[model samples]
Target chain A: MDTLINIPTMAELSAKGEQPDILFWVGCAGSYDERAQRITRAFAKILKHVGIKFAVLGTEEACTGDPAKRAGNEFLFQMQAMGNIEVLNGYAIKKIVTACPHCFNTIKNEYPVLGGHYEVIHHTQLIADLIAEGKLVAEGGAFKGKKISFHDPCYLGRGNGVYEAPRKALEQLDADLVELKRCKSNGLCCGAGGAQMFKEPEPGKKDVNVERMEDVLEAKADIVAVGCPFCMTMMNDGVKHVEKEQEITVLDIAEITARANGLL
Target chain B: MLAQIVFTLVFIVAVALFTVQVRKIIRNIRLGKNICRNDRKAERWTTMARVAMGQSKMMVRPVAGLMHLFVYLGFVIINLEVLEIVLDGIFGTHRLFAFMGGFYSFLIGSFEILALLVLLGVLVFLARRLVVRLKRFSGVEMKAWPKSDAIYILLIEVLLMTAFLTMNAADYQLQSRLYGHYIQAGAFPVSQFLSPLLPSSTEALVFIERFCWWFHIIGILAFLNYLPISKHFHILLAFPNTWYSNLNPKGHFSNMQSVSNEVKAMLDPSFTPPPADPDAKFGAKDVVDLNWVQLMNAYTCTECGRCTSVCPANITGKLLSPRKIMMDTRDRLEELGKAKDKNGASYHDGKALLDDYISREEIWACTTCNACVEACPVNIDPLSIILDLRRYAVMEESNVPNSLSAMFANVENNAAPWKYAPADRLNWAQGDWSKE
Candidate 1:
């Protein structure tokens, strides 16, 4: 028995509306993580504020088999992915937007191997677009007083090459931003990916999250904003564990954007 | 004279085995034995070259690269000494060109100095393994592990170096005895150092020469016998493996061998043709599941641990240690040969198919990341084997995880990996981009 999580393709989804053509994917990470949900709704609000018609994928949104495939459980990945293909096939889906980097990467890079070709886009890409379009103008706006920095989730940055989108979105908001020394392609894993969200980290050196948190504190940024749900969960949990020394807030990039728009 | 005879036989045997293996590899190809991938053969060969000879993977970690470069160069240069020793045994003299002495002397001297440097390099390598404590297989400390192959090679190098030094000391004593007798050439630094200590007898020099010669020759012979079994075996296998590598682009996979051309009228149209096996009943499940050249990789592996050291899954602490996957297969193969009927491997209790041979999680952990395949120096294609097993698991066994289950259905039914309205196939190109 297979349960299908079907999300429409970007093009079919994009044709549903007009400008702010966001091709959003309901990543498995988003399905489970609260932070990811917050960020996206905020991003959606901001995009709406900027007059972008974000077409939704309807019932077609599902897991993109990245975790299942990477986890070496191709059967589960395929079953879940089939549901997606069927849904996308039912609609002329176009232009994708998703909060999770894993989803972004999978739908973008891996979908073609299985024949699910689409011009996929992450939510950050749309935010970057909205900002570039001068529609979601947040410059010297919402988040002006908050000192923040971005965590390039592996799936988003290194996994799919969205290295600049998340930063650009924040720049559009004119948030006080700082960069971690180890950012971009060299970005460290939150140690919570590839269904690692469910497994325990090996008992060796430091927790990868804490290690990453220390890097954020070292960057001296007050808030650590991320686009990936897993990163947010790990970083937020890590903040509580290491909160005695520094007061660091771990928010999803969407949440940061939402705050910029005074939406959430 | 006894040493000379033994040396010749050992050399002959080693060379013979190496050539036969290489030649059989071509025959094996003609017979289409280890065609283990769906990727183009040319592509696989290219990956092998770029990884093996080009050392593309080694550059990932700088320290490891420098260490391997020295070790690889040492093996190449030390080979000259092996040839020299063999020549000495046959000709009753160590020098190949005796009358033309000056250049020859310089060549041997330079070799000895280089060998000395390599010997020192060996020490540094040992120190790194023992002191630096690199994690090789599954976070296991390599230094503490019983690396029989590496340990033995290091021992041989030390023994050879010691033998050379001792023979030099004794040879100097004898050479000084003839210092005045053969004073035609200008003084040599090495000989001059031993001049005062030499006893005035050419017999002593000859005796010491013969003694050092015996140790060096014996060491070479012993190493030859171990070539097919030891980690250093890549020394013999690397040359040909690199030379005949599947040279193709990285992105392409070998085309699957179409079974319709090979098999005739079948017993059952629905039998699925058994996935291209001649015996159809006996199928490969592991490294021994491989043909000779692949199994040959067992001996060919330098065990530089370069594959394991750089594997993305391994670094991420997944169960698929590419090095372990190779070493385990080699170990299992050896176990099979040693078994009473060469079939004593406990495939089931070992979870031979999935969990034990390679953990399901470990196998799944591969992002299909070519990091390990790209990292191996001797051209071992772990990725190919992994994918092959995946194929078996997917097509025949239907053992894929639930995630892929949906995708497979989507592929077979919808003809696309993602869900879309069948009528709206052209929607991807219709998206508006300027609305932001």
Candidate 2:
């Protein structure tokens, strides 16, 4: 899993008198969460493999204020949003992509209302697009017959109505992709949405993540695929909760694609 | 002459009671903050037509939807006959619309058919609640008076419709006998079947007709007054609720004004943020903090449990139920309304809707998924209430879950929800992948 490629930063590109085709918004989870870092690297590998001109905002990147807003701190959220908008408007960045559904949703849907507008895309959508254009070929390789189930992230599935792009990315792998009983629009949350990722779940009959994990387990897939880093964390935790960590692996669509393409 | 005088007195009392209830409700709703939803006139009207008038969203469950459509039509269309009843009571006329001949017959016949359908609908609804054991109807929130209120409304409608039919039956019986004051006029086909069941003596028949006529009219008045105190208040509020619905994209949440202004000031070089009011509430601490439309939504809740049934959090055993949120708002609003009525206009007993009615755990459980908003036939936005309350908890009270506190700290200093500084954001792309 050696991802030693030279990653260009926004500052570096500005110094080079050039701009990348897309500004990769490496979200908080992707930037620092150990489990989510793999997703960031995998997506970066796919971007490099496809020869797409992409650059990370690097140190210049800040959160899109999704969690802050969802947590009901509108003041903090707007402060963060305004700061990012200033930097983005300064650089005149046009197209942006991120592997985190939370960031993608905030930037695409919430930012424009705060005076920041860009062509925002999620990484699965990018991978799906690349595969469709035949620019990046996903051969399935070792994953040809593997059982994989995609857990739809709330922001990606219900928030954004993007049930197909992730599936398309998985389809490129030629793996046996399965559906949870409550997939697509009726998909359940992984208990990490609405800023719940930062808070312990309130006392309930059952944790939302454990309940959602039951659906994944019922599907009995060896590999659980996710499109969002938040979903990856929650689903991976769900797998661990049931002590099925040795039997099942939770991964992002980018990781699966990267693995299938021999990049990882 | 004596009977007409008594009818006038009864009418005056009923109207007075109904008017007082309505005025009280309006005043209570006014206690809420103002919001401007008047931007989209055509869309608002269309929403009212489709949701309140057409019951379009109700049809998602065909059996219940069609049944509700029948009951709704019965309640609306049968009221036209009340116009005739009122005129007759005031002017000492028998069957005031009888002069219209065929049209009167047609209207009466249609009313009879609708009444029958309404009776059947009410019966089925009652069965669903009492016998069929629908889980949504028998929840903890719906215990005691909530359950009784629902059953009582259904039974009252049954009684009203039955009284109307009985009065029609007695009138038909008297008309068949060609009694002096009982004109041989108007249609009564459904009641015609019930004419044989009336007492043979014209004296007893007149007594039956007069008793039912008074009962039916008085019951209608009672129902009108009861609406403000009942979940069936939706009967009056749904039209306006649907009309004032937020027509924005379902995923979009309205930005707070104070927050937006501060953000604008931050972005502009020459701009300065407005002076903050020390007494200003951050979000909703009580019903007074919520917008009028949200208060209207509280009144508009039918308590059908459709939103709660589909709520993912509720489905997964979370404490959050959108139905309960609306109910709690209405209950707290009612409590506040009662206090204002009892005490002075400036009354504040220190109880707020936040902890008193709704809890922090319930508000936090919501994912803001808009599932409840989507499921609401009347377009009640429970998510908005949840967000506002959460806003109060986080921004004003500084009382969020410990994990959220950590995330906030990270966002403030590290520019992310994680502990890593912004400079190390690209570490994932740089080194140490071999450790994996």
Candidate 3:
């Protein structure tokens, strides 16, 4: 935890006439939300620990227009998209990684049409790859024998067909990875997607996150692992809503891997 | 010869009525905005084959899948016998294809078996709807008509299959008795069991056979006409619906080219703007505003409610039911079609799909999770229609919830959904992990 990690911005790297291996897209929630910031740090720490050269956009990073697009402001979404694409294309960035599924989805899938194309990947996919490459040796330090359920982020799982990468990262933890009744392609949304995190849920019998929490509790999982920052916030709020924060813990897959590897 | 002439007239009328109804549906679908889904012909064929013909998506629920497969196969295979019926009716020949010998026997035997399977499938479907009462069948949108429509189709299948088997049974009895024109032609595996139930009188058997033959053929023709108005139209539309599926990654919502052009002009001084049509709208306000594929999706939806069952908004008790969205679209389209027919093409009902049929509450409740899209067996994209409605609501009407308005303002001014400064974006990296 006390290890010195070198963090460089894309501007700093460009100033030195050097380019990192990848540009880490720290999304709006990752940059602004306190809880999501921890996930961003954990993922960055993993990248640093694995000796992967990566740089952050820092002040140059803006919203990927996911919320605006989903919330029905196509004009606003395009403006934001064009701005981010210009910055990215200017950097001549070839590959990108993000802890947020929304950013990963937008940049990887949606941005190409607007003249910005990069080999975008989610943080979990990168961790899975690192583990596969033996660059990151994940040991089950605290999570061993504990029942961990992975909550699929809508954009990452159903939206983008990435179901296994996060689970692969969890598999290395040597924990009992129990699946929620609805997992993978059928995975339920955590209610924070489609910009719902910004607004109160339209009145219903229960909040969508609260409904998803029931799935986790039904599995009797001691820990709920997530891949997206939005899901992280929603699942955490769900735990609080159920007053099970004392018994059940919610952590992002990056944070879990970071903890299990004793990097945090 | 007189009987053949009367049969030909009846067949012509049935086919003509069916053609008229189908043409109306096509016209209604064409009323929608044009979208190019014809790209990737090879992929579309594969999708149609896999999703519609192969019932690939149906396998999500094994019980319903298998039952549906039985009915679907039976319905398709047994319909081949209709060709012989049509030929015989035109030429005044009994078992016109009976000269094919063993192959004809094999075909008749297969049809008999398929008819039995169709009966079993229809019964199970009825039981699922009436007795077990599957949750997918019962929704707020499933009122008297929708519920009965399902039952009626199942019951119609039962009656049709019964008439076919009864016709075969009488034919079998007459053939065994060596009655006139009742030639020993085709095999009857299933109807052989029913031959025992018939009377020994040859004339009575012939009368029974003739009655069932007319009934079965007329029922099938009536069923053909019934398809355009019924939810059962999916039997035909599912193929094209799956073919023209939104093949992009489910996460990738389509970018509006019109909005893109306007945004480019705003951002770049050198960018040229296209001459705008005064009537151009941001997104769908009514059925006519939706893309043709989306309109076909409305026609393709059989009210299975698989989309609603998997929808997070619907599952958590929100008002958004994706099945209802498709149903409402189809209903509004039908209403508009009828209005146009009456009012000569410039019909205005003053009601749009957005407010009148689909509510603002239902529209706002969606999380855009694509669960409904993933759940649809025929690849019906209720999410696309929902998103289009959302676009209209936000872009044209500027109608949004208070919280979303604030989020929009933040994204507009501060470059994030929250009120945080862009300068503080890198603050997360400065966090002292050493404190832990």
Candidate 4:
């Protein structure tokens, strides 16, 4: 296993009598799912490169309970949500940045109703803010002139309406940033939302991810840039379905930025 | 005198029939669970004005919107003349509002013009369904009674408008001959064209006028009763449905209170959580588990297929059709309603909306995208019903798809929907930090 460096947990920071600028919410997918773990690392590298003080919850972190809630397991969802909120409140966490749309959506929109209110932002927004503030610089390295089409994740695009931040982060790559036909508000789901990601699709004429992949193919881009980890999985599977895995690559916006900025 | 007596009997019978049907509909709608949407009176009224009264959302497609607006306005405004017609029938008078003189002329002339417009509107609507075969209207759900019901409504409108115009034409001809109680008070510009072709004899003119007059009144009553069973129930229910629409952000889902209480017990340090109720259901399992507003929504759907046309799931060839969801709810409710009537208050059909009316495939196919809710001009929410049913499948029945089972297990065991433990969450952060 590749060892991570210079990361601190809430407990470790408290033991050192210090606090970071922001709490990095390494969501379950980003923590465990191998492909998504790269996205987590890419975003963390950006924060480190920019010299922003950030800390993760380490063993104290739990799932944000989004999948449980959406899957209709209210009992399980509440159990998970309350557990995370208790730990968050214990750390007196204020600002949180997450790489997962599922976590961002649940904590930002849902947690407040359960009395766990805090400033929550997706990593794209944080990176975009960092760029705008001149704290970090991005450049078009390997991606210059590359045709990159963005796949808007439901939780990020329609659910929360943060359509531009990821695109803005992509603009730093100086790539041909193309949009799918069903872009922005009308963008289709990757057949992975509503807990559908965890199960086989009900028999249908076509899988929703394959249908959405048609849009990605229609964009005729070399790279399918995504924000959410689930979308990354769905789109990657879609590319492989068409035997175009070698031609098309699915990269999180953070991963692309980290690579372009030579922080990898 | 015999004519007046017969008219009174017809009116009494027609109204009683219509009243019974409406009561049955209200009772069926009340079978669903209660949800309080009475707050925000000002916002609700504004929504009614904009959506129902102004017909704003319909204007998204201008051609259909304008055509529908004509039919809607003609139906509501022309009914004002029904009041005068009923009075004339009851009291043995002719053109009862004729005493209002010039104002009566304006009202009569307006009704004549509107009658022609309504006739034109229904004809175009019929042609669209029968000739043009709009894809939305031709979908599988529209194959049987739904197809015939639409044609029937348009055909009825055509007949009703024809009867109205024929009555006006006969009255005009009778007025020209100075027939009994036929006054030359109101202008009938459109029907006047037909006045010349009518028989010149006074009694014959009176006979034609009387037949049409009786037919028009009876037809109107039948149409009112037919509305309870037809998709045209939207004519009566749209106003309330639009007024009761959720004003929250489109993506916001209603949190279950049962879940909230448990979360509170966990979050608040001093408070102890109550033991889980053994019989407490997590989400909707049947029609009765759904809120009254959702039931009202099912009743209000026009079956216009606007929602299905815009749905990503439907368009992408998924089994899910938002329109089908609404139709299935309405059908199930009607089934339950009839059983209640037949069984004299102890009715159990031993069937439900889930699996029987709507399939697990249909509910699972939806992305919960809210496109259907946005597309519905009447603000009928199909997404809510789908979510509730999915909740039943996952929580109550434990019949979720295998992949979802795996994901749920991950969430239960690892605080997320992945198989990773909490300690390694930041493993991705480990790399050369100062090399850059």
* lDDT (Cα atoms) of all candidates against the true structure: 0.58, 0.86, 0.92, 0.85
- Candidate 2 all-Cα RMSD: 3.5
Worst 10 residues of 4 chain B by lDDT: B427-436
Per-residue lDDT for B76-115 in model 2, tens only? 9999999999889988998988889889889998999899
Root-mean-square deviation of each candidate, in angstroms?
Answer: 8.4, 3.5, 1.3, 4.1
Candidate structures ordered by DockQ, highest first? 3, 2, 4, 1
Per-candidate DockQ vs. reference: 0.07, 0.48, 0.73, 0.38
Candidate order, lDDT descending: 3, 2, 4, 1
Candidate with maximal DockQ: 3
State the lDDT of candidate 3 residue by residue for B162-255, as single tens digits. Answer: 9999999999999998989999999999999999999889988999999999999999999999999899999999988998999999999998
Residue pairs with backbone overlap in model 2:
none
Error of 3 at A40 (Å): 0.7
Q: How many residue pairs collide in each prediction? A: 87, 0, 0, 7
Q: Per-prediction TM-score of chain B?
A: 0.74, 0.95, 0.98, 0.94
Cand. 1: chain B TM-score = 0.74
How does the DockQ of candidate 2 come out?
0.48
Q: Per-residue lDDT of B1-436 in model 4, one digit per residue for the tens?
A: 8889988888899889889988888998998888999999999999999999999989977878988988998999999999998888899988888989999999989999999989888888888898998899977689899999999999999999999999999988888877667878898989999888888877888888989999999899888888988999899899999999988755567778777776676667787766777756767877888999999999999999989987767877777889999999989999998988998766788899998889878887777666688779999999889888878887778998787788888778866676776566666666554443
Instruction: Report the Cα lDDT for residue B229, model 2.
Output: 82
Better of 1 and 4 by lDDT: 4
